[model samples]
Structure formats: structure tokens, C-alpha cells
Target: MTTDTAAQDAAMPTQPATPQSRAIKEGKFGKVIRTIVMSVVAIAFLYPILALLLAPTRTEHSMSLGGIAVGSLSNVQFAWAQIVGFDNGMFLQWFSNTLIMVVGGAVLAIILSIPSGYAMARLRFSGRNALIFATLLLMVMPNTVLTIPLFLEVSAVHLLNSFWPLILIFGFYPFGVYLSFIHFKTALPMELVEAGRMDGLSESGIFFRIAVPLARQAVALVGFFGFVAGWTNFFLPYVLLPQTQSSTLAVGLLQMISSSQLINPEEGLNVQLYMPELALAAVVTMLPVMAIFIAAQRYLQRGAMVGAVKG
Candidate 1:
């Protein structure tokens, strides 16, 4: 009887080992496949940026290869030209203007969103659920779809030429509000909020002190995304801001490449193929977001992964 019992136990254990081993092997294989796919996708996305950064053997485009002498594509020369072309500090002005738009817009968006999200997620208020649902729905709609209405609204206010129009429009990111709302609702515990209240904190006080403090990672997440959106915004700024005073780097780059005088062949130009100025502008535009990401990658990564559900 003892021998039979031992034999039964050993056979049962060994029988299950095969499936367990197979599952682990399959999991590792799946991870390897995912890694390979992601690596390929990343490389494909980065290839164009790499090619643009690298100096070609000759500075000629296939579009008009027959036009001019092949020259070296020098980053310094192009950037310098972009910096001081047409006796104008155009790039510098655009850089400063973009700084104002991006920073001001992002700061305003975060300032409004954090409290609004906290209130919706934690506080009992009239129309809270309705508002959040409306926000999510509105956010899913393309910004382009709202452009004409927004333009008319800005025009009605007579602030079209001023940076205020663009600033105000971009500063209201419903998506950020939703993201923060979901994050705080799920990741933050009710106990912490209740504790703050028990300690005699006001509703507003509890939000500023406890909720926000605990939800810093998610705030950073919203801030980064909002910043990127504002930074790379094209249509609103291009449409609202007048050509002379408030144009951003994007609009300025377009004008630089479009003006017939700038691309004149008298200066031995190959304007259609490549504008080193535009290339430099592209690099300049991308650098800040890249720097921000590189600097705060750790916190940014955490914030992006805040997979919390909204109550």
C-alpha cells in the first residue's frame, strides 16, 4: 500500500511538469516575438530622421538632380543661414514665439485639468458623470473638425491676430483631463482622502495637499502629453496668429521655403529639393520635446503606465 501511494504521487507530479514547461517555453517565445516586432517598428520610424541627419554623398534631390552642383550638406551652415537669413531674426523670433505658446499653453492646461479632474473623480458634484462622458467624447473627435467653429468664435472675440486666441484654444485639453481623472480615481485610495478630511482639511485643501501630491506621476503624464501637443500644434497657430508678429516655427518654416526670392536660382539654389533652413527648423522644433523626454524619462514612463480606472 505504501509503495502504491508513493508511486501515484510521483507519477501525478511528473505528468503535469510537461505542460508547465511548455507554457513557460511558449511565454518566452512570445516575449521574443513581441520584442522583435517592436524593434522593427521603432527602427522604421527613426529611419527618416537618421537619413536627414546624415550628410549625403551629394546635396542633390532626385526631383531636380539636373539643376545644380552637388555640394556638402553642412548642418552648421544651414543652421547659421536659418538663424540669420534675409537680415531677419526670423528663426529666433519663431523660437521665442513657440516657447511662449507651448509653455503658456501647457501650464494653463495642467493648472485647469488637475483640479477639474480631481473634482470629477473624487468630489460629488452635479453633472460630474455627464461632464466626464462629454469630455471623453469630445476628445475623441478630431481637432480639425472643430477648427472652423473655433475660428469663428475667435473671430467673434476679435482676438484672431493675437497669440491669445491660439493660446486659449490649445490650453483646453479634454483628453488630459480624462487621463488624470481616470488615474486619480483608480490609483488613489479612498482611505487617503478620508484621512485628509478627518484631519480637518477642506475639500479644496484636501485636493491641493493630498490628492495632487499622491497623483504627481499622473500629473507629469498629462503635462508631458499636453506639452507635446502644444509644441507640435500647427493649424490653430497658423490660422489665428498673423504672419508678422505671432507665427510659430512651423508657419515660419513654410514661408521660408515658399518665398520665390529665398529659393531663387540666382544664388545657385535648389529650393525644390531641399531647404537646409527648413531642415534646421525641423531639428530645432523637435529638440525641446526630445530633451524633455530624455530628462524626465523615468517619471514620464511611470505616468504613462498609470493604468487606473475611473470610478
Candidate 2:
């Protein structure tokens, strides 16, 4: 072809016949397929949550009927009243206990992690490598494995049957330690510390001023995980604080379910009381986790993979 014709052809954009490219260009079949697949996956994950949310609003009769229809607001109000009224406002007490424990654990974990991780990452200390290795092992090991040992320790210390054990145990999250360590090791710039040092800042001053702000993403990540772990923890609190009145939501829910059946004059035994109220408790317990996850989404997405791969 002529030189001008070839130049024009080279300057023009080219389109490929790949399915994704064609889908974007034409906006049809491939988009439809992807949309359908995502919709199916979304429903698969969400339907269970939807059912749980709906349960508190439902009655034995409506739940047994097997339809998608929502129940009246009165049923929701009834379930709420029942939960709050159970054992004379025990639910509120349990909720307050849980909040205190969760906040204490999360804050302590973050506070300890920031310094410990920074030391492990920046300072030359004995057993640093061993500590990192231990943190990794603890992070991977199922929490149940530590329960027996932790129980023994707590019992020996006379901290059992109290909130301190729950708060302290949950606060000592090795995963948070490891996350902060990895973040500092991989993402932290040593030049900043040196720069601070040159400017007459002590190690503590450098860490507090330079390192902390740069590590906010890691802090959010660790704090979110710590909070969730503490919130959902069941076996530890159940075993540690055996008192019914001192139960957190997870243990409280378990207690409610275990004692679900009730005897009546008209009926020999029934589980009707367990259904709606238990469902309501479960939903209420999970709300904080959902809220935190949503609020921390930006930091989570940004920092989740920060230290996963080498820089």
C-alpha cells in the first residue's frame, strides 16, 4: 500500500476478537454471562444471611410454611422485647461486657503490636527471628489449641470467671503482631527513621511521629481483625467466664440454644421460644462486625496485601 495509507492504518486503534474485548465493545453476551455468574455467587453467599435476618421477624407458623414473604414488624418487636427481657435485661449486660472486652482487646493489641512489630522490624535484638517465627506459628494454629493452656494459666492466675481473662487473652493476638511486623518489614522506609534521627529525634520520638502515621493502614487492618476475633470468640469466654449473667453474646446465644426447650401444660416440650429470639440475638451480635468491616473497607483493601508479597 502507499506510505500515507500505511501511516493512517498504524495511527488508528486496533480491536481484537477476544471475548472480553468484544463484550466491552459490543456490550452484550459476555457481559450478560459475567453478570449472571456474579449474581449467582452473590446470592449463594447472601441468602443465608438474608434468612437469618428474616428469622427474627418470622413466627413458627410462617417459618414452617416455607415462603419468601417477610413477616410483620410486630414479630420483630416481639423478638427484640423477648431478647432484652430475657433474665431481666441480661442481654444488655452481656452486650456491654462484650463491647468493653472487644474495645480493650483491640486497643491493646494495636498498641502492643505497633511497638513490638517496630522493634522486631527495625531494632537488632536477640530472638527477633524466633519471635517472628513464633508469631507465624501462632497465627496459623487454630485458636482452640491454645484454649486449654490459656485456661490453665488463667485459672492459675485466679483470673478465671472475670472479664480480665477474656480481654487480656483476646488482646494478645499473634496475628496482629505478625501483620504489623510484616507491614513494617516490607512497607516501612528506614530512611524516614534515619531522617528523624538526623533531626535530633529519639527512637521513641521517631516512631511516634514518623512511623505511626505511615502505619495507619496496618493499624486499621490489625485493629479490625482483633475486634472481629474478640467479638466472635465463644469457647474462650464460655470457659473462662462460666457465669450465665456475665456471658457475652456468643456464649449467651449458645446458652439460650442449649436451654431452648420449654415444657408447657398444653405441650410436652417445645422449641418455639428459641427460634425468633435466638435469631434476633445472632443478628444483633453480627451487626458490629458488619459495621466495622464496611467502615474499614478502604484500609483493608489497601493494606491487606501490603506485606503479602515482597516489595
Which candidate ranks first by TM-score, i.e. highest? 2
Across residues 106-153, which tens digit of lDDT does each residue of candidate 1 receive?
Answer: 888888788898889888889988998898887778888888788888
The TM-score of candidate 2 is 0.83
Which stretches in model 1 have alpha-carbon errors above 4 Å? 1-43, 55-75, 260-274, 297-311
Candidate 2 C-alpha error for residue 189, in Å: 2.9
RMSD of each candidate?
9.2, 8.1
Q: State how far residue 305 of model 1 sits from its true place (Å).
A: 5.8
Model 2 residue runs over 4 Å out of place are 1-35, 262-272, 302-311
lDDT of each residue in 13-52, candidate 2, tens digit only:
4843466654446468888998999999999998887888
Worst 10 residues of 2 by lDDT: 262-271
For candidate 1, the 10 contiguous residues with the lowest summed lDDT are 55-64
> Would you list the clashing residue pairs of candidate 1?
none
